[model samples]
Target: MLKSRPNAGRSQPKQQQQQQQQQNRQPQQQQQQQLVHTTSSHYGLEEFFDSSRNLGERQVKSGRAWRTDELRLKSNSDLHKLWFVLYKERNMLYTMKEAAATEYELFPSPERIDKVEESMANLENVVRERNNAYWQLEVSPCATGERPSIFRRDVFGRHRWHKCSQHIPPYHRNWHFRNTQGPGKTNETDWFFHKYREMKRKHYNYFRSRTARYLRDLFRRFPNADAEYIAELHPEFPQGYVQHLKENHVLYDDPPRAATRARIRPSEDVQQ
Candidate 1:
């Protein structure tokens, strides 16, 4: 009687196991599909494309730049998100602009890129303001976390603000450092400085002389013109110099009366 059901239990169990394996794989397949869809939506190729508009379209009007006041009102996280949005927008615009240039076509709404840049600048300024205020309150009044700059003279003896960095000081014995520190107080440098000063002085004198001559001619042409207006317009001409020109310049002279009209004499024949 037991021999009749020899393969029945094994066959039923194998079929059940197969069904269970398929059921387990179904959820995983659905999960994988869902993940792929989410990823595609988040980072799609569509981002590189501009908004739906014809290639020949031009002059698309847009809103003004984001103001610092408006940006300051937003939370840091929101600002961060906005920055990335604007950054992506700028990159897209640049791409579109280059494409238009290559195609010999006009780029629509180029100012939109400028607006984006200005908004980004405003956002950064607001963030920097907050950072500075926080540093002042929690740390020290003068302590901004930014790098400090030192006033240093270049080879030309021009003063410039150089950012301090992690490097050997100018006084160090390093040859590279000494060479880059500029020609300090040598006879050659002193002579060069003297020559530079002399050149600047000559330029100033030449400019002053040219300006004086121009003022002299202007006053001569417009003797009745407002002296105060002239002075205001050309402060480079000193008040005393302008007054002297007004008083002493010959061009300021009034024109002499036209010679009296020649007396008309009637012909002798007409008298007869």
Candidate 2:
């Protein structure tokens, strides 16, 4: 028991120990570098900065938007990844646009934002389609978890589709405690509705009068214009209104030189 084993406390060689330390350090250093790279890559301000060519350019040509059909063909996972990509792109573009505006420089290829938006919308639609399909196959139709909406009249009597959310049952006395508690009609609301109706009526009358005046002016300016063509063009105008304009506004005169020349020149050329 008192005698120690010969190799029990033997230390590694300096060369071997140093080599081992170097190997361990390599991986740790590599990991640190990778982490730094990842962190820098995700910086929002860096992403928002424009490329050299686009920084001060007036007009930059870009490609079209991602089509719905193209997005539909992608897998859910792929679309999920692409959604974040587009979202980041949109944020970057918005930031760049704001910067450019502040600097009084043109934001080149502004339509890129629109393209990214279109792609994101298509992606969302594809995801929604998949969700609907999954719900139909695995869950009850009513269990899709989307908010149900119904056309309901508000306090002002305006009908709109109100999105319904889970709430306390109607029988609960405190259920109507919310600031937006509904179905309460007041005199103020009635008066507001009355004014809204009156404003709408005025707009309707003004639009009708404008249309009549335009028709009268057109008839006066081009007396020989085809009544049937005019009626076809303005199907919204009553036949009686068209006839009234023709009889009252139009002056019977020879056709304008421009119209006569256009008609006569073609026919003479044909005869020749």
Candidate 3:
């Protein structure tokens, strides 16, 4: 009973110390809580909207898209920032347009989306041009400097640009590279290539035949139309066929120009 009493006495002070430490921590936590600013978390979300335009505004005047020359003058870092800005603007516009559409209203200045898209395309082309120039100078030996790719027939027999990786000289003898790059010589591939060629041939013939039919109808309807100009549009027409059309037909209208002219008798000049 005496030993148990001393143990209990030690435990009571430890418990009191813990309670005091917790009491001290409570005020610090309370101070931190008090110091924290109570700003709304979504305060920055207004960025996705055009503040200048009212919800019911019929027209929102915006500037033209960034031209290629303008974008080329910008540094890479500027381009990077502009890309994000345009991206965000596009999103904002899309959201606003959707909101307006949901209410069955016309979105203000829909052409703004086109301007944004054009700017984005121009920006990408600028970046791509820069990349191509750098690669040509530093990394690639190919003309485009955009990693040399060969027209490879895939396993599906569709031609795809198969990008080649660079290596030390004498790449031809590298059997492993050759084997890995192309489609395997299998029965399926052989069959596919045959069918693929047939499909391509059919596609080519279909278009050419359609062009011929169109040319025939065009020549029938408007014989006075320039055969040379029509030939320029589709130069595949044989020279003989074009010359035949030029010589035989003059007009598809009711009467030929030669036949329509009223005769003016030469007797008037004789009398004078």
Candidate 4:
């Protein structure tokens, strides 16, 4: 009879059991559903619709990147929220820059805040895309449009531009005109033309004088050396001048030696 008595407080009451079941089921239901935007703070797009909404002014106050392992532990919903946070930060920074420029004041921390926000956005996008692709077995979506290019007309039919990594549409109305003043002046043909000719003339004269001096010195160095063989080695070289060196014994003598520089030799001595 004692054993048959119901064990006191062995199980929760029916009402309590129901409440616990509801709590567990609620989290499961949330996990099963896709997240939706509760606020359009990312692009500052929601500002136009609601005047009472307070968009925070731009401010830079943060430190360090979240560790990859920490980010990996976050749920998809949390990652989405972080993405919007960074997007909002970028919009705020842009707003501050425009306002500062309009007021002729320095944009405090200007590009720094924007760069930080952009880095976070990029990292988040990469992580999200990787997760999405892994889960769905599909490529991440990217913007599509006309390729980037410089517009220039050639002598032919109509044309469009293309570039290696362009993605924006080419609005012909907004095309930036390059070389508006047309072809530049040709100093290359006229100024450099005469300048280069003068340089070449000077160089030719210098080399010619140097070659003649070398031949004369060669004969003087070896007085009894064969002049014919010397002329044969330097066919374009002046031979008559070297003959004068041999006859004068200019550099051929040693020690108390020839004291004067030799003049340019006649061209007749040079072999054809």
Clashing pairs in 2: none
Q: Provide the overall lDDT of each model, using Cα atoms, as 2-decimal numbers.
A: 0.81, 0.76, 0.81, 0.58
**After best superposition, candidate 2 residue 66: deviation in angstroms?**
1.8
Write one digit per residue (lDDT tens) for candidate 3, span 210-256. 77666666677776778787777777667666656555544422466
lDDT of 1 by residue, 1-272 (tens): 59758688779999999999999999999999887754334547767868776457768878999999899899999999999999988999999999999998899989999999999999999989989898999999997867788887766665678776676544555667656765456777778878988998899899988776777777787877676776787777666767787767785544555655566788988964
Tens-place lDDT per residue, model 2, 157-199, is 5767888776565525555533255644778878888898899
Question: 1-272 in candidate 4: lDDT tens per residue?
Answer: 56545543444476688999999999888877646546535635644221222223344445555555666777778878887766666676677667668887666555556465656756666586556566554433442222446554322211335254532644444334213312223555456556767887899889877776776666666668887776676666565755665677564444543556566686997886
Q: How many pairs of residues in model 1 come into backbone collision?
A: 0
* Total colliding residue pairs, candidate 4: 4
In Å, residue 157's CA in model 1 sits off its true spot by 3.4
| TM-score per candidate | 0.55, 0.62, 0.56, 0.29
Ranking by TM-score: 2, 3, 1, 4
For each candidate in turn, give its C-alpha RMSD to the true structure in angstroms.
Answer: 11.5, 12.5, 14.2, 20.8
In angstroms, give how far residue 224 of model 4 lies from its true place. Answer: 42
| Candidate 1 stretches greater than 4 Å from native | 1-54, 80-107, 142-146, 166-178, 181-272
